[model samples]
Target: MPFKTYLINKTNNRKFRLDGVLRSRRLPAKHKLCQKFRQHMVLRTDQLPPKVDLRPDMTPIEDQSQIGSCTANCLAGAYEYLTKKSNGMNMDVSRLFIYYNARIKGNY
Candidate 1:
């Protein structure tokens, strides 16, 4: 079957209207990075230093095994960094929780 038909059937099983949900959501405007790049006539390669490590202070590298949870893992890492910077607390957000939530929301 076609992708659209598959999506329609899946949404129907969940008693959800994909069209209505999509229509209700507002599309995001152009990203700030895109806007900044658009205004420049030529790319500025010299502005940034040769070796810049912008890694957060307390954020540690994470490894997500065989499962398809890279996005969730990255989000958890970012959350950990933000929380640590905002307050001096080193809290570990569960990647599994994020992954499960995203999966349930039909985003995975």
Candidate 2:
């Protein structure tokens, strides 16, 4: 089946649409890295760099090609949240990165 992308910005409640198709099943099976990215991160949260808090600024992120790659956005947001938490400052994460990662995850 062909998949569509959709992105929603939590900060300003904006939405971004992208034109593309993702065949989750067709993703290269040999690229274990692709499948394991999230899992790997989950196991080593403490080791990973802390995320920044971006809520204070709450600047919305962009929707990447409308591909519904929210995971990347969430990751970016987390980074922003952590950053702010550590330094008492906020940051805007790149939504494009989130959208891209979501599509890579396929059905994530």
Candidate 3:
């Protein structure tokens, strides 16, 4: 079944379509993150440093080339970043290897 949704503004009424919006299933309670792991910061602008940028320390962008392996690419980037920041090594991680093991670990 298809349904129509409308959005109205005080000044002008506009028609909008929301049928293509996607809804995801909520994660099970057991899978939810612990309260300690979740951070909810409340701070004024002056409380923090004026600027913090880490792009210069990141590895060069890796090309996925139309592969549906974003999970692998993301993990590889983070791993490379940690290695570079900690050991001062700019080694590149293999997305193919990560994707392969990720599929196995995830049972995909």
What are the clash counts of all predictions, listed in order? 0, 23, 0
To one decimal, what is the Cα RMSD in angstroms of model 3 from the true structure?
Answer: 17.0
lDDT of 2 by residue, 1-108 (tens): 446676989999787877575545556757765664553335467776688654564535556566665667667877876777678776777778667556677774
Q: What tens-digit string does per-residue lDDT give for candidate 3 at 63-101?
A: 998988898999999999999998889998899999998
Cα lDDT of candidate 3 equals 0.83
Higher-lDDT candidate among 2 and 3?
A: 3
Cα error of candidate 2 at position 3, Å: 47
lDDT of 2 at 25: 57
Q: After superposing candidate 1, which stretches have Cα over 4 Å from the reference?
A: 1-56
The global Cα lDDT (0 to 1) of model 2 is 0.66
Could you give me the TM-score of model 2 versus the true structure? 0.33
RMSD of each: 10.4, 16.0, 17.0
Please identify model 3 stretches exceeding 4 Å from their true place: 1-47
Q: Highest TM-score: which candidate?
A: 3
